[model samples]
Target chain A: MSADNLTRTQRDDLRTIAAMIVPASDAYKVPGADDPAIQADMLATLGRDTKLVAAALDHLARLAGGPFAELDANRREAVAQEFRKVGGAAAATLVRVVLQCYYRDDRVLRSLGLELRAPFPKGHVLPDGDWSLLDPVKARGGTLRRAP
Target chain B: MKDPVDVLIIGAGASGAAVAWSLAETKMHILCLEQGGWMNPAEYPSTGRDWEAKFYGEWSSSPNVRGRPEDYPINDDNSPIKVVNYNAVGGSTVMYTAHWPRLHPSDFKVKTLDGVADDWPIDYDALTPFFEENDRIMGTSGLSGDPLSPLTHPPMPQQPMGLSGAIVGKAMNKLGWHWWPSDTTVATMDYEGRARCINLGHCTPACAQGAKSSTDITYWPHAIRAGVELRTHCRVREITTDENGMASGVVYYDKDGVEQFQPAHVVIIACNGVGTPRLLLNSKSNRFPNGLANSSGLVGKNLMFHPYAQIYGYVEEPTDSNRAPPTCLWSKEWYDTDLSRGFVRGYGVQFVRGAGPVFEAVVSEQKGILPWGEDHHRVFRKLNGHRLGFSAICEDLPEEHNQVTLDPVLKDSHGIPAPKIDYTISENSRKMMEHALARGREVLETAGATDICINSPIPWGGWHLLGTARMGTDPNRSVVNEWGRAHDVKNLFIVDGSIFVTSGGVNPTSTIQALALYIADQMKQRLANLFD
Candidate 1:
């Protein structure tokens, strides 16, 4: 949980990979996970998850044969591919954390056309779908076996 | 306690709550001790915007993952399926999906019908009345004439099946198979004691609408109003025995970690399958050396879990998806036995609505269907709000090998040894799952779905814990007798999932509550001779 353990280079690598994971969606009008404000939230939340993030960064660097932060765009892409191929618990933790934080962002939620609030106190609703869809099954009834 | 209470019940979960409510009719002095406290819906994860991301912490369904003070650790390293439960006043019902379905008549006499498991001492016909009564009390919602279910037309009108249910229903119709609107213990409209559901998608992590009919909301309140005293945060260490080998009471730790012994005229254990057996095996006295009322040596044997197979795919049409209660339709086409299918018994197909946003992202990434890089949005858009699937709840047979023993190394906060599960998916269940997967995929394909995926015998589907302490007429083969009373110890009773002889292919919560009520009725009817 100690942020001091994660090298500055690792933090930069994490943000870089996060942006690649959820790049800016111009069509949907939603910013990427690496948007300044969103990335700040992500970094703050990553305090407790620093250990996993650091381990994942080290794994990416070792797999790429150098520091991920110093890698060029093409090399970063190749390294990410290799990292995805060699997926482990640490990588999964980072991915899970990243997606979770990204989805919870108010901007991304608004793009999804969902209310930027809790599900309860004003829970969602659905139309009462047609129940006659079961008429066919009702016509072909008596599927249960009797007890001997 | 100085004065012995008339009846002492352990574990104020699903079964315990119902029995307490039913036995309260006698106006007898009954007390139930629950390890977990009552849950506050206001504090439930759904109340926050980040619920989807936040619920993975304290609201987790797995006790081992949640690790709350009241939850005991289960050593499930030996089993393929991990146990998932919520330690609360409503028990696992707090986190249950509320797909309430009763066991078929043939389920009670499996030996006589398909010749696999032992026959239940009591039959489904005998439990029909109790089932109906429990449905009314639980405010069950469903349509009638479900030929597959033992009892159809749960007290409340059928909950509206959203578009997802319609798609699955039409698909099953195309296949000429059985499909019906699922009976659920969720309120469709405002009932006497509960409120209407507002479709808060997240049913697993606890529903905040008070629409889901958890015992805490259904039975515990009624039981409390009927003079049943329920004490929370009291973890029972062991069941104490008397010199004559008759029933006694329990030794438990209070909230402040103070040890106390409470005596009773009669003892009733309503802890679920795992907790029930763990308590019995831990209560080793000279009167019953092996374990209390475990002369048959089958106390913790024959553990049964409904192996789950999730089959889903992507569709073009957008659905209500995560905005509604997930399960509303089920097909029992393969529910009955078919020898040619390479399986003796069968499985039930429960339809699940698509995943929500966080779920879609996480699961799709895990499945490698949605990548993290460039194509992420394309794949995510294709699957989000368009995924429709169903899970096959496979019936498990009784095998002595898959048992729940006392974990010597692992113990709870109260210093009680935890339950160590040793289970393996049986070949019969595996065949059932495979058959279910193939048939389910065909149905989904017929429903105009693509990108099909099947996760067979999923490990996290260990929701139904059953058959650890089974009931039978033979003392050498069972822990309890025909009426849930222990054959070895008079005035000792067990009214929980532990007494299930065989695992039915559907959810067991409804059956568990009905059995509890039935046993309570039996106790009342034979009050004079109950201890005999």
Candidate 2:
């Protein structure tokens, strides 16, 4: 998607910003980092770095503080806790703007492990309504599960 | 194929599935035809947090049953059955927002009170038993608060969710308003071997842990076990009737797009509000010219979609907006004949937690309340701990102006013209909204929510479309008889939301399913007497 064609400085700044937005974690590493192999799929999908893409990266990084490469779990969370401290009215607005940009960016989709509006899976095999005829096990009276 | 089945059911959605399930118990030879393929149990989206993405995917991946373009093709204006329906074995049940509330007794006699629309052929009392049966079958998780719903034998097997329910409960209790656990089809326990709802947060597309009781997971299996045949990916085009005006069979496009004849003694059309009317209009035959079951020339008149407004609030506590289940608490506080305040029928107030942080942030950011740069960062900090949202559903009167007609030029993949909708909210609907907003404000005040924002501008579109092919007492006015049978056709039956006389303030699925059951029984008894 070639991110609206970013300048060299803008691209470097965006990479730095993305590094901060998607901080590293032992559970699941951020898509982009010092490792060139990671986030390559996302980068290809999202068109490198557009203005909105750059803004999203910057927003995530500013919230987390320092680049994602440098942050530990505790440090990364401390930054997220700051988001909560700000309250819903303002915080909701910020998240919405960044998500709008991220959702559009192929990189954010890859980072979050998502595609951009793919169709639902096909070839659903509806029961021929002949289960009893097929001698399937009957598990009647099974509507008694506890509500979540 | 030697002796045609008594009833060839098409589309195992709420209406078709329920009708088939009800008939299967009688040991009748039944064959249900569906246009979509089967669903993978493992691929059910509600199983995980990432399932939200399913809403954006292909029609097949869509959490809704009306997933593919072929399943939900509309005319140019997107008016005829404007909404998408699922096509799997369960039909539209898989993606339904499980908000089931019974119609008020007065809803049957709308013309008597509102001076518009005709009275139902059968009153609420007649349908009460079927409603009860529906509650039992669906495992409705409701409270004993509403006197309108007097089901005591089968208690609510499940309890409501935590945060949203509690908030509404507290607010309603404080104000002396009536509230209850929403009547839902989700399994509260491990009923019938289906896993309980793990509260995986996705109820629309697919139940992740098998808690939601969509027909495929619930009734379809039982019906299948009782010797019913469900053929998927077979789209029924029109019913072919004999010279005697009896529906002999249906000509349909099979899943492979081949034209196949599904001959049967009786044909039941439960395709839904939009599809049902379209099928009737399209089934033009030599014996009857104005399409099937539409002798009154009112097949697609009186289309009514419930008008609603979403009132959001910014609260102090962390409401955990990212919890499982899309909708939970419902309020019927104003769902009555409270005309003293100057409205005909009242509305219902349903409270639900707001969207997730990412989704929430995205919404707020679009408002430009948080522009990019440092301003965006500041907004994120604010949304972390926010309590928000209460959606108001106002009742819409049955007005003739709101109608669904076939498009003159535009056609879908099947060479059928799209359904064009000519709709306008009535003056009565405007008043209903005004009353609902005032009550919502009171709840927000009671809950101590700060910076309350009321955003309601006449609902545009939702799947809850109702009241096109209404049931009525007079054959001159209504299209169907007391049992949802065609006034003109002896063998054709229309069971779906289209038969609703008036649009209630709650979700219509429960009532639709109940009506399907009631009609199914009538068909069963009548069909059994073939040799008599």
Candidate 3:
């Protein structure tokens, strides 16, 4: 919603790029990066490095031969592949920000069957694993350094 | 503020806290000054939605990146290794992984055995009792009778190794290597009022459950309860000496940036390797022109950083990698020297879990292993829980050229000269790393891992800063004597990793604490003629 550093078209193009990276499917009803919450997070992260975002978006627009958001799905995919091929700091930053925002969303956690709670206050409990697998290691005696 | 205390400690870190706890038994007034304040568990990153961001932001373990008001940055331009430290009351323990391992018996006599690096003034047997005492106080959890180490019992039960540990253990068995569940300072059950670990998995930035044994919760509370005074946010600028060249007290900047001097009967420097040398070098006077205790001119020389490497791979099965601590299992089979490998000392290998989901996604994308469009999810899922990693902690010998010096231009917030680190990996360490990487690949392959990616020596791996002011018997070659007492100034002592003569192949926290306790005992016995 607060695309302070980005124009309207740039925001839409970024949303499209994020959606292509992690598109919504029926198998896991997770929201794509086009979701409002996810977009806001992505925009905030992108706002930190506005120059990098601007450069990456300009590259995508040139690859698609127009506004990247106006391109079809196939064209968008091709343009994204072109951007990936010409990998630079801007492209890497864009991918990193988009992935960080998408994967940390609550819907993604639910889709992955994980509780959306803080890691502390009520930490996760792991079942006791098989200790017998270490029997062989324990059977081998001490391997101390030999004294001079 | 009130009066000159019986003893003055410069840092409230691991060694300082331990020394305070031990010396409090003598009923002497003990005071400690810490540059950073107490860390509250409630303010930990895990309690927020943006927990992962903390690792890259304010909660970063490196002082160069964290940049708090009290932090002093290190000029690491000349070194391949970067220095990482946390300056709070618990020192680097606040952000450490809590992997506690003692030095081997031969680690004491490195010169006699390997004909390189000076032997420690004190041996492992002499410090065994203190190590055992520290384990009881710090609440370590492990099984007894590790063949690679001397026999010792932990007070708490061991943590679960989970699936990754099982796979790695089986691989070590196949390779006929010595692997064991690493002894950690995390509490399993409620021991000594700290809560049990719930496997939150973020042990580096901060442990919110109060499970990891940072010195603030482990030793500081006990010391404070026994009537020790700890002044937070007070940074010591220089150690002042009397007319006779004996350490009388220190001139420090208080919490409000006010300059003040506190006199004490005995002064102890527990401010780690770099900080200790910086303070000593900054305290230049007419009596000691080069530095305070630099008659030997070795105060900031012979710095050793344990060169580290991490090897990651993808396992075949879908196993849970986010359910346990960061590291719970390690191998010492390659710890000692093997002449055929063309290296002097060896390295320890640890099997650890990968970071959180977000971190993994970033790493995978950056490494070009995961594509951007359409193929992201597939590669992410394939590498999610089905990943394993091994980190090698290689021993770096003492080299006179790799040292800590005062930067002429760089100044901290207090206008003090910043510590300049000049270090490079030795040929011996490079050969050791090569051998360790090959061995790591063999282990991962034997354990049925594919798509293996082995990284070079990690750049941000200078967690264990040691050997700047090495301990020895002769005054001409060393800064401190066998008892951690300065050879030049009788009333001055250093009880941190700075007194280490050699950098061992494991984490240095356990040995640092034990040496602090041992030095405190020596002070108690020689109380009558301490300044003589």
Scored by lDDT, the top model is 1
Model 3's i-RMS, to one decimal, reads 2.1
Off by over 4 Å in 1: A1-9, A44-54, A61-66
Q: What tier of docking accuracy does candidate 1 attain?
A: medium
Q: Which stretches of candidate 2 lie over 4 Å from their true place?
A: A1-148, B1-3, B47-49, B59-70, B75-84, B147-155, B368-370, B454-461, B528-532
Compute fnat per model.
Answer: 0.77, 0.04, 0.64
- Interface RMSD of candidate 1, in Å, is 1.5
Q: Compared with the true structure, what per-residue lDDT tens digits does model 1 show for residues B1-532?
A: 5578999999888999999999999999999999999999988878887688755557777788678898999999999899998888999989989998888888888999987789999988788889989988888898888877665657778877787877887788888988888899889899876779888888778889889988898888889998999999999888888888887788989889999999999999999889899999999888888888899999999999999988999889887678888898888888888899999988888998887888788878878888876677777778889989879999999999999999989988877888999999988888888888999889889999988987877777899999988999999999999999999999899999999999989899989998999999999999999987
- Residue pairs with colliding backbones in model 1 are none
lDDT of each: 0.86, 0.63, 0.85
RMSD of each: 1.8, 10.9, 2.9
Estimated TM-score for each candidate: 0.97, 0.78, 0.93
Top candidate (TM-score):
1
What DockQ does each listed candidate score? 0.71, 0.05, 0.53
Per-residue lDDT of model 2, residues B1-532, tens digit only: 4368877987788878888888887786789888777777677754333344334344233223233644545542433223545667777777766667777666666667665556677777777888888777766665444443334334454344455555555666677665555667776566666765555555666665666778887788888988989988787778888887888898877767788887897788888777777778878777778778777788888887777766766666555354545566666666766668787776776676655544555555444443443344445445533655677677777877677777777565567655667766677777877777777778877877765666564222356768778887677788888787788777778889999888867777878988898888777677645312
**lDDT at position B416, candidate 1:** 82
Model 3: which docking level applies? medium
lDDT of 3 at B74: 94
Q: How many clashes in each candidate?
A: 0, 64, 0
**What's the best-to-worst order under DockQ?**
1, 3, 2
